[model samples]
Target chain A: MERPEAPEGAVWAEHVAPDGYTHRVLARGTVFRLANPEGGACAHVLLHHVDQPWERLNVADTVKVQWNAYGGHLLLSDQGRVLASVESESGYDALCGTTPKGRDMFVRAAAKHGLGKRDLPPSLSFFQGARVRPDGSLHFTGPAGDVVTLRAELPLVVLIANTAHPLDPDGACTRLEVTAWRDQPTGPDDPLWTATPEGRRAFENTHEYLSARGSA
Target chain B: MTVVAANAGWSALIGAGQTLTIVDLEGNQAVDFLVYSAADTAERYSAQDTITAQGNIFLTTGSVLMSNERNPLMTVVEDTCGRHDTIGGACSKESNTLRYGHHTRPQHACVENFLAEGAKWGLGKRDLVSNVNWYMNVPVEQDGTLGIVDGISSPGLKVVLRAEVDVIVLVSNCPQVNNPCNGFNPTPVRLEVA
Candidate 1:
């Protein structure tokens, strides 16, 4: 797979092969981008708060609050905190969780890294499509190769696994390219600096926690 | 190896042939659990496989946790808490609001606990699964309905599992306060491995 050019000013970048995984700790205000360079790849992503490690991204909350599962949304933390804002050009799958086929490949890849099951979490199936039918069954869809960019709301520890979605017809995997760069400072008028009512409250709560810990 | 606080999360990697015991230091604390293959993230615990193989929904002594691939990951070697829930999934802020009210939204839940603890090991929300609710009481009614009720366990009750493969175990000392599942209060639990 050919490597995609990193965004200008990118501080670091890496390409994850099929069935590979990578973990990184990103600073707040960083723009982290994951792109399926060869198409037909799924990058399962997870995030956690750097200071309060227990407050991590809540995928279910992300869907419930938005009332939609499509891409281009804010991923919320369990405390209603904004972990990251997701902007995807290729879309994501909301109905399907990680499948046995994907898990098998991840296991093989993890073994090479000396990581155990504790290191494996379910994924937010990126660049894949599936919908829940009225009858409760799922219908898989295709057309991969989307770039998903996440702008961090807080310092985060992120994990991404590159693998095939269960619904992929050929079960084939492709390479995933990741680019991370410090985002330009946002002014008060910038959307990134604005918050929803709930988000504002969450931010306040986080501030309180930090203040209590003498870290604010 | 760890003593998880009430409403907290804990995680560990248990190799093949190792046994891990969870002690309910205080009775009635629901311990939410998820397990994955140490070597493969995808080959994790499957509630469907375990339920199908056992022909039962409750986990107990001798019950083997089957992965999504229908392979055994861990076997329940001993149990003082006679039954554990296989379907009462980890609690989350969403579920708390849906089941109780919006007022419960700010409360910490099992999902947060799992994510927080699992993150230390590089695990995330995408890795959560239909977990085992150790010490939780979810009784299935004759009409196929399920009820999360007061637990039957007493203080010091324990359950043990022997890993069939190298596996990672993630746990949440369930912080649910909206229901009787945790007796309206969450408490600490003890974890020991041999």
Candidate 2:
């Protein structure tokens, strides 16, 4: 993985190669962005509260609370805490889940880096489009360039792995560029801060936890 | 190769042809487990697939863990605990609140143990799935209802698994105190790889 040139005034940037992975702890109010420079690429993203590790992102809860599996909004933690809210996304499919091949490849890649299965968390598949049928099978629609920006609600330890979704046909690995910067407060009335009822609860829980711990 | 403390979590890479023996060091303890194909993180242990393939809800000697992809990841080669629950699943804060009470929310649970331990290897919550509860005695009533009862396993009981492929196994020394699965008190377990 080569370090990418950060945009003007950005905190950090990196270019993740195919099968490459990166883990970083970003402070709350950080704006992180992932851009698929090439058309066909997907990244698996996992988020955890930096301090309260147990209070981590729960994909099931996120899906259930919003009744949507598409990734373009607030990602909720198990405690109903908002970990990160999507600022923008392009070229990603929200409907398709992980494919056996994609999962296997990620596991192998993690193993090579001395990480085991436990490290292989479920990720929000970004940039691969698909539609699910009535029978629970997924059909790939097409491919496009996907770029997503997220605002961290709590200090988070995020893991991003450059992997393909099962819907993707095997091809040359695509390059992924990531950038992060400090974000200014957009206030409580911002839609990003008030996306869903569950998100509001999560934010409250996080705030309460922080306040109780004297970290607020 | 590891001794998972009571209410803690342990994870390891068990290569193909390797065997992992889990011992009930203090007896009547439940060890929650999840496995994935080392080659692909997506190919993870699936309780539904395994139960459907074996026609049994309880895992024992000779039970082959089937992955979501319907591939074998590991095979149970030895068992002194008699049976393990594939349906009880791991204890989580949500489940704790639902079954026990909201007061139990702050109590530690298996999902917490898994996330805390798994983070060391980059795992997050999305990786969690229906997990195997070793030493737990969740019996299916004739009407298809399930009951969490006292474990059939005593001290010194053990179960062993042989990895059919290079695999990663995650274990949560269950911290569930609101249920009889851990005898209402969680304890340590021993992991030996051979």
lDDT of each: 0.71, 0.71
Q: Which stretches of candidate 1 lie over 4 Å from their true place?
A: A1-3, A51-55, A99-116, A184-198, A203-216, B1-194
Name the runs in model 2 displaced over 4 angstroms.
Answer: A1-5, A52-55, A89-116, A184-187, B1-194
TM-score of each: 0.55, 0.55
Writing each residue's lDDT as its tens digit, candidate 1 over B21-124 gives 99999898899999989888667887645754665557898899988777999999999988887655677875565445558878998888887877887777
Global lDDT for candidate 1? Answer: 0.71
Best by DockQ: 1
In model 2 chain A, the worst 10-residue window by lDDT is: A88-97
DockQ of each: 0.07, 0.06
Error of 1 at A178 (Å): 1.6
Tell me candidate 2's fraction of native contacts, as a decimal between 0 and 1.
0.03
Extract clashing residue pairs from model 1.
A54-B116, A103-B42, A107-B39, A107-B40, A117-B38, A121-B127, A122-B126, A122-B127, A123-B126
Model 2, A28-80: lDDT tens digits are 88999888778766776767777766556565445434444444377766665
RMSD of every prediction:
9.0, 9.7
